[model samples]
Target: MKIDDLRKISVIGSGAMGSQIAMVCALSGYQVTLQDIQFESLEKAKALLNSQMNKRIVKGKLTEQVVEEAFARLSFTTDLKEAVSDTDFVIEAIVEKLDIKRQLFAQLDQLAPPHTILATNSSTIVSSEIAPATNRPEKVCNMHFFNPALVMDLVEVVQGPHTSDETAEITMALSKRLNKTPILLQKEISGFVANRILGKIMNEAIYLLENEIATAEEIDLACTKALNHPIGPFALIDLTGLDVHYNVRMERYAKSGDEADKPSSLIVEKVERGELGRKTGQGFYAYN
Candidate 1:
């Protein structure tokens, strides 16, 4: 199917990423459904989206009429079948766990329209690992959007071996429609492009903190002031949530069986303490 054929979008999981994605699609004039298994999760997503959209209006980035129309175009549900029954595209932004993703894809494959394309928002778990769970492997590809999807500009579109050319092109086109910069990876790779580069930096930052070579603030300051990076590794981790990195590391370790691939001791402790970053009110630095 062509990009024009995609009239409806269903985002599975009502967390921050999923909610922002649904809002982006709706704001771009597509009908969108944001789905989660729990009612409370859906409510939180609603509040989160409303707050962000209102911020856009306050900043004059978007008009009130436009935000209202975007809100009007969105629907929320707990029923997976109801969410995907007529959707032309499905973007999965649930947990990073491979088994959970495969299970959800299996269900989405059975529920979504036969012509719908399935895209994953995972930067670490490539679509190749999840495509086998569905009959339409050709329609499965990676459309990894960075955290805080509404504000972040970059999206990585990964085309797996089983993915069709049309699927990749359409996903790229759709991402552009959402006003995000889409970088196409002709071949699938774990962590795609951006995250792979960022992971190395994050690991080194964790090592430095663990060795007491520098504190999180000092390391972050060095990255910003010396390297000229817009944000420090530790600050970026906090913005994106430490749990996400922890899961990526865990997944890598699970597959490689190498202790070196395991999450850093610092990250493990932070996640254990529920200091997941901006969403949790604390991470490397505290947020009010």
Candidate 2:
């Protein structure tokens, strides 16, 4: 289907990524439905969206009328069937578990309209694996968005083994409509492009930390001062959540085929202890 034909959008999972995606779609003038298993999570998502919009208005980035119109275009529901019922596109931003994503797609395949596109906001999972769970494999692809989806401009539009050319084009158009920078990924490489490069850098950083070669501050300083990176690998990992960083690393380690890609033992131990970084107020450096 043509991108203009997509008027209604559905986003699964009401976490930070999903909620922010809903905000983008709503502001883009698409009718948006944000869904989650828990009604409370949906409520929380709505609250977060409103708060963020208000912040934008206070900062003079958006007008009050724009915020009101955005809210008018967005809705939330816990009923999976209702959420997927009439959507032109479904963006799945659920947990990073493969089985969970597969089950969700199986449900979407049966619920969404025949021509509705299915995209995943997954940063690590291979699109090919998730595509098979749906009946329309050609419609399933990856539309990975950065964290805090509303603010991030870079979006990776990934094509799975079975993804149709139409699906890629439509998503690219949608990304542009949302005012994002869309980078097409022609292959299903592990971690796609951005995350794979990030994974390599993070794994090496952890190795240094594990070996007592440098403190987190020093590492962050090197990237910010010397390399001119806006954020250091360790700081970025902390902001992204150490638990998430370590978990993705483990996935890469399993599929990366590079010994250096394996996560450091120290990283696993930290995540096991629940030091999830900014979200949890602690990580490589204590946010508390």
Candidate 3:
């Protein structure tokens, strides 16, 4: 279906990325259904959306009327079938587990209309890994959005071997309509482009910390002041959550059987201690 013809969108997760994506679509004037199995998660997402929109209004970035209209176009639900039944586009921003994602996509394929496009917001796993679970592999692709999806401009549009050109085109156009910069990848690679490079940097940072080459603060300062990075590696980890990084690394290690791909000792300890990051108020650094 054409971009303009797509009126309703369903975001099948209510976590950080999924909620922000739903809000962005709603702000762009699309009817959005934000679904989560847990009602508590949906409530948290609602509060987060309100707080974010209010902050934008206070900063003169968005008008109150616009925020109200966006809210009016958004709805939350606990039923997946009800959410995807009438949606023209379905963006899956759920957990990163391959089996879990495959199961969800299989269910979505049976629930959503034949013309509905299925996209994953996965950072490390490729669409090819998830497409086989469904019959319509041609309609499946990856649309990876960075953390803080409402603010981040880059949305990587990944095409698996089975993904049709039309699916990629429609997704690219949909990303543009949300006022994002879309980059299309012809081949699907694990971690895609950004995270593969970023994974290297972060692994090196952990290596430095592990080997006692530098402190986290010093390493972060080097990246920010010397490399001109807006945020340091440790801070970025905190923002993205230490548990998330650890999980991704564990997945990589399991796949490659490389010791170097395993989670850093420090990250493992932190996760065990419940020091996730900003969400938990502590990680490599503590937050107020």
Candidate 4:
């Protein structure tokens, strides 16, 4: 389908990424449905988006009327079928698990219209792994959006061999409509482009923390001052969620059988303690 054909969009999952992505689409004038199985999660997402919009208006980035119009175009639902059945595009931003993603796509393939494009916001799992579960493999591609989707400027659009030229082109066009920079990778890789490079820094940072070479604060300061990165590896993981980090590593190790792909001891411990970053109010660094 062409970019103009994509009028109604459905986003599965109601977490930070999913909510912000829905916001992006809604603000861009697309009718957006943000879906989650739990009613509480949907409520939380609505509240979070409202608060964020208000903040933007207060900062003069958007007018009150514009925020209201965007919210008018946005809706939340607990019913999966209702969310995607008539939508032109579906973006899955659920937990980073292969089996779960595959299951979701299989259901979405059955529910959504045949012409709907299915995309994933996963930064780790490639679309190829989940596309096999769906009949429309060509419509499935990785549309990885960085953390704080509303703020991050770069989106990685990875097209696997099964992805069609039209699918990739339309996704790139949609990204532009959302007012963000989009890079297309004709070939698909596990971590895509940015994450693969970022993963290396995260790995070494985890090692340093495990070895007690430096405190998280000290390391973060070094990264911000010397490397010119806005946030350090630990802080970045915290923003992305420690459970996500642990899961991505575990998933990689399961596939590659590489010891290096296994989650670090620090990550495992943090996840076990339920210190899953910003949402949980604590992670590598405490929030509030």
Say which candidate scores most in lDDT.
3
Off by over 4 Å in 4: none
* C-alpha lDDT score of every prediction, in listed order: 0.93, 0.87, 0.93, 0.93
Residue-wise C-alpha lDDT for candidate 1, range 120-231, written one tens digit per residue: 9998898999999999999999999887888889999998899999999999999999999999999877878887888889888989999999999999999999999999
Task: Give per-residue CA lDDT, model 3, range 1-288, as digits (tens).
Answer: 788799999999999999999999999999999999999999999999999999999999999999999999999999999999999999999977888999999999999999999999998888898899999999999999999899899999998899999999999999999999999999987888888988888988988998999999999999999999888889999998888888788878878999988898889999999999999999889899
> Candidate 1 — which residues are off by over 4 angstroms?
none
Q: For candidate 2, list the clashing residue pairs, or say none.
A: none
User: What TM-score would each prediction reach against the true structure?
Assistant: 0.97, 0.94, 0.98, 0.98
Q: Give the lowest summed-lDDT range of ten residues in model 4.
A: 201-210
lDDT of 4: 0.93
Clashing pairs in 1: none
lDDT of 2 by residue, 1-288 (tens): 898799999999998889999999999899999999998888888888889999999999999998899899988898999998999999999877788899999999999999999999998887798888878999999999998788888999998779999999999999999999999988888688887777677767777877899998998898799989888998887777776666676666677677766667777777899887887888877876
Top-down TM-score ranking? 4, 3, 1, 2
In terms of lDDT, the poorest run of 10 residues in model 1 is 188-197
**Local accuracy of candidate 4 as per-residue lDDT tens digits, 253-284:** 99999998999887888899999999799999
